[model samples]
Target chain A: EPEVTQTPSHQVTQMGQEVILRCVPISNHLYFYWYRQILGQKVEFLVSFYNNEISEKSEIFDDQFSVERPDGSNFTLKIRSTKLEDSAMYFCASTGTDQETQYFGPGTRLLVL
Target chain B: QKEVEQDPGPLSVPEGAIVSLNCTYSNSAFQYFMWYRQYSRKGPELLMYTYSSGNKEDGRFTAQVDKSSKYISLFIRDSQPSDSATYLCAMGGSSGNQFYFGTGTSLTVIP
Candidate 1:
């Protein structure tokens, strides 16, 4: 199976600082998304992007959160200002079409101080 | 109530044991059901996917969905020690882009 790859498997930054997590989705996939799992919690969807625009976002995706498909193959999630609660395992996933299975990248563990 | 509910199990069983993992959902509009396995801090790996209701089997794993009951299940036969991980049940609404995931159930298949 084709795979999605995320950079910086682990990142640690201070509170109030900015951070960007990058992912290289499968070449043919058109829809991309970001989800995060806090310790001992279910994976929650943050946002979904397609056609270079966000299609849907969850409540957890507040003003501090943003997503950008910077180039043809890369999708990124940026936190304008990190908070302590922001620490979690952020997962990037992509799918060929809607209602289909999403393939996930290894994941980027973000640690906000 | 949560849209999706699954038992967070630290279910331990010996190799060759039959394992049953289950989830219950409240929404009737959900059109797709899926199960994923995550190991430690790694991302989820899709193990089985089914549409609507019924059962689908692959090798040692089987997935069943009963839409009328709003219940779904995954059964692993002859479980191996390598199967130890967290299993999450996820459902997709009619819109496809949005999905609801259950708190994963952790399982340890003892050798």
Candidate 2:
């Protein structure tokens, strides 16, 4: 079956540096999302993207966060400046239609020091 | 209060035992319910999906949703060691594409 895939399975960056987490959602998917999980916490929604625009975002998706669908298949989350608290497992998900099942990628583990 | 509530259990059971996992939500607008499984250091994999109220079964796994009570459940029959993982319940509504997830319940099926 086709699945969402992310690059840089794990990343280590300085506290103030910028980081970009990349995802290639299923080719035919129209909606994309980003979610994060702090080590042992519940998965938290970050943002949702559709039609090259943001559809919804959570409080955690503040000024530092931005999402882009620079190409047909690539969906990326960029953090302008990383904070220690920003370290978490970031997952990219995509769904073919509204209210459809969302498929998740393996996730990118971001570690800030 | 948390929008979705779930037990973060490290529930351990022996092989062939049945496993029951559940989650409750405060949002009445949530119309779609789903269950996901995550292995250590990996992303979540979709296990079951349900719309509104009713039961959905896929092989040995069964998903039950009670919209009136705002509760959902996932049951694993004859569980195996490979079933050891964290199970997360997620809910979504018609208004948006985002999903709210509960703290996952970790299960260990020892063979």
Over the stretch B1-111, how does candidate 2's per-residue lDDT look in tens digits? Answer: 889999999899999999999999998999889999999989999999998999999999999999888899999999999999999999999865889999999999999
* Per-residue accuracy of model 2 over A6-90 as CA lDDT, tens digit each: 9999999999999999999999989999999999898999999888999999999999999999988799999999999999999
Per-residue lDDT tens digits for candidate 1, residues A5-70, read: 998899999999999999999999999999999988999999988889999999999999999988
DockQ, prediction 2: 0.83
Q: Candidate 1 on B16-107: residue-level lDDT in tens?
A: 99999999999999989999999999999999999888999999999999999999999999999999999999999767787789999999
Docking class of 2: high
What does the lDDT read for residue A69 in candidate 2? Answer: 93
Error at B18, model 1, angstroms: 0.8
DockQ of each: 0.83, 0.83
